[model samples]
Target chain A: MTRFALTIEFDGGPFMGLQRQDHGPSVQQAVEDAALAITGEQVILHSAGRTDSGVHALAMRSHFDLEKLFDPFRLMEGLNAKLRPDPVAVTACEVVADDWHARFSCVGRRYRYLIRNRRAPLTLTRGREWLVTRPLDAKAMHRAAQHLVGHHDFTTFRSAHCQAADPVKSLDRLDVRREGEMVIVEADARSFLHHQVRSMVGTLAMVGLGRWREEQVAQALAARDRQQLGHNAPPDGLYFLAAIYPDD
Target chain B: MTRFALTIEFDGGPFMGLQRQDHGPSVQQAVEDAALAITGEQVILHSAGRTDSGVHALAMRSHFDLEKLFDPFRLMEGLNAKLRPDPVAVTACEVVADDWHARFSCVGRRYRYLIRNRRAPLTLTRGREWLVTRPLDAKAMHRAAQHLVGHHDFTTFRSAHCQAADPVKSLDRLDVRREGEMVIVEADARSFLHHQVRSMVGTLAMVGLGRWREEQVAQALAARDRQQLGHNAPPDGLYFLAAIYPDD
Candidate 1:
């Protein structure tokens, strides 16, 4: 058996998310079907992050085991060809040890949220970006974001449907910046509670809108209640940027 | 009669360009209909540049005359509300002299083109960007662009069906820059021929791909023949960035 790692990119708009579901299409199912078409074999693929519906991934790495010997790069090319019409691509493929797991072997994950802050409706990025009609204060959002960086119980930010065993996790970084009419929020952590990033962004938007202060974020964190947090920013604005590993 | 100068923004994916055409829906028609919906009168609108279909506009300035004393700002808001689901917006409106014309009064026009140079098939920006699979040398493209920056007949870069009376036009600036996997080409001029920018980009792309040399661009221009140029690029990646005019 050979274990192979693949770097993937996908537009999650039409997908139910990274994982396969009974009702609709998924990124994983699309890739698996493509692989089946190329190799005529059924296999389960493991991803570094399980992104929700409407989320996008610039580079999401995954791994799977195949029972036969095949050229790694050719497999990737073949899989991509079969995956056409679906907004998903397998960019890289490399042979790895069987011990390597895409999810367990990962050290951290990075996410980016893009907000088109303008009056005009996004035509090209309609389903890909979050549009905010009101101008946001990036400085205030940045100040409020600092309160969430570090080890803490993120109960207020966690989704009620979150399956994480614990709410306490270390957030290594959370930065918010604005470029022209775009508001960008970048976050990195070893792991995250379900909907944590979206929840935080929704709350930070209130701060950016001058409806909430920086200290309010701290109060929400201490509340340990999901109801204390702001709305969930749409999944459209979120992207699973990358997953970091210990070695190349 | 009162002349109203308005700044517009639109997603050019659905229309045949900025100009009204006999066949398809146009940005001009959409805006004009929106205006007519609010004022209950027929009005003629003029634009700085007549962009082609699939091109976007960040700021396209235009003007229309109205006999009704409707508040220009309020009318803009009303028109925007009426143009919903079409991805058009009237961002700013002000009263101007009756002689003001959206097209004739413009001193310069700025345009931006986006080329996504990556191996992955575009997932998010399918209709919004030009996806070039070949390796593009932006430096070579930038160096070659300088040859067409100054005053030139630009016959090679103009469309065969262009209705311009004269081919001689001064190009104020032409810049090619790289941002991540995207190549950006920015151009500014008093005006342009029908398909000039798209034609130039198509030729520059040939240079970037090593199919054409830097000197080839000059030779094509000096040839003073439309057949000497490369193919006309699609309108997907183009943008009407802004139209500059002197203050009242």
Candidate 2:
């Protein structure tokens, strides 16, 4: 048996999310079914993280083991062929030691949130970006974002349904910048609570729009209460950018 | 009557083109219908240039006369509201002189073509880019593109159905550059023959793929025959970037 690690890219508009559910389709089910069709063996695929509905991934990492022997390139091609008509693609695949894990062995994960700051409605990037018609003070938002860059109790940013054992997590970076009409928010961490990035971005948006002062973000984090959260940005603009492992 | 010049942006996936078509929907029809619905008067929508089917536009300049006086912002907002569900938006609007024509008065037109140079199938940007599996040398393509940048009779690149009186047109700029995995081709000209940009891009792609040498491009242009054309790229990757006017 060989363990394979796959880097995936998918449009999250069609599926329920990355994880399997009884309610609707998922990126996991699509990939697992594709693997089953190729190997004739049902395999459980594990991902680095679970994304909500309408959340996209640029290079999500995942892993699964197969008893059948096949070339890595051939396996990737076969799976992509079977995933046809669906917005999923296996961009990269490689063999790894059985001890390697897509989730537990990961060292870092990065996410990018896209916001289109404009008065006009989106045309080409309608579903891909969060549209904020009101003018945004991206510089002020960036200044406020610096307050949440280190380890802290992120309960205010954690979702009510999050299953993390503890409310504390080490956030390595949270940077915001404006690129043309897009206000990009990049977050990095060793691990994250469910909906943590979205929750933080939602609160920062309030600061950007002048609804809250820059220092208010620090106060929200200090409160350590979910009720103090400003809002949860929609899933349309969130993207799982990459995952880093020890081997890299 | 006031002639309002509007900067429009649209996703071309849903419309036949930017002009009124007999058999299918077009951006012109959508705007005209929206205007009629708002002002209770028939209006003709003229665009800077008529884009082919499935060609997107970032900021296409156009003009239409309205007998009823309406504030530019109100007209723009009302038109966008009525253009519901359509992938079209009026990004900017201003009143212009009666003689300012969308097509005739346009001094420069620019276009951009996107090509994804990768082995994997596209997911997030499926319809928005052209996928080329083979490796491309953007530098070589750019070098070969210089051969077409001056005054020339571009008969080989002209479409058979092109209505331009003379095949001689001076191309101001034709640049090819690679950004990460994307190969972008930007073209500029006072005016262009039908399918000129796509045809040029297709030929440049041949050069990039090493199918045709840089000199072969010169040879094809010197042939002055449409039969000598290498290929015509699809409209999927083409975008009307912007239209330049004299007063600006």
Note the Cα lDDT for every prediction shown.
0.90, 0.94
lDDT of 2 by residue, A9-56 (tens): 999999999999899999999999999999998999999988998999
Model 2 Cα RMSD, 1 decimal: 1.1
Query: What shift in Å separates residue A143 of candidate 1 from its native position after superposition?
Result: 1.2
lDDT of 1 by residue, A131-189 (tens): 99888999899999999999999999998889989999999999999999899999999
What C-alpha RMSD separates each model from the true structure? 1.7, 1.1
Error of 1 at B56 (Å): 1.5
Q: Which residue pairs come into collision in candidate 2?
A: none
**Chain A of candidate 2: what's the TM-score?**
0.99
- Candidate 1 lDDT: 0.90
Instruction: Quote each prediction's TM-score.
Output: 0.96, 0.98
* Model 1 ranges off by over 4 Å: none
DockQ of 2: 0.81
**DockQ for all models, in order?**
0.55, 0.81
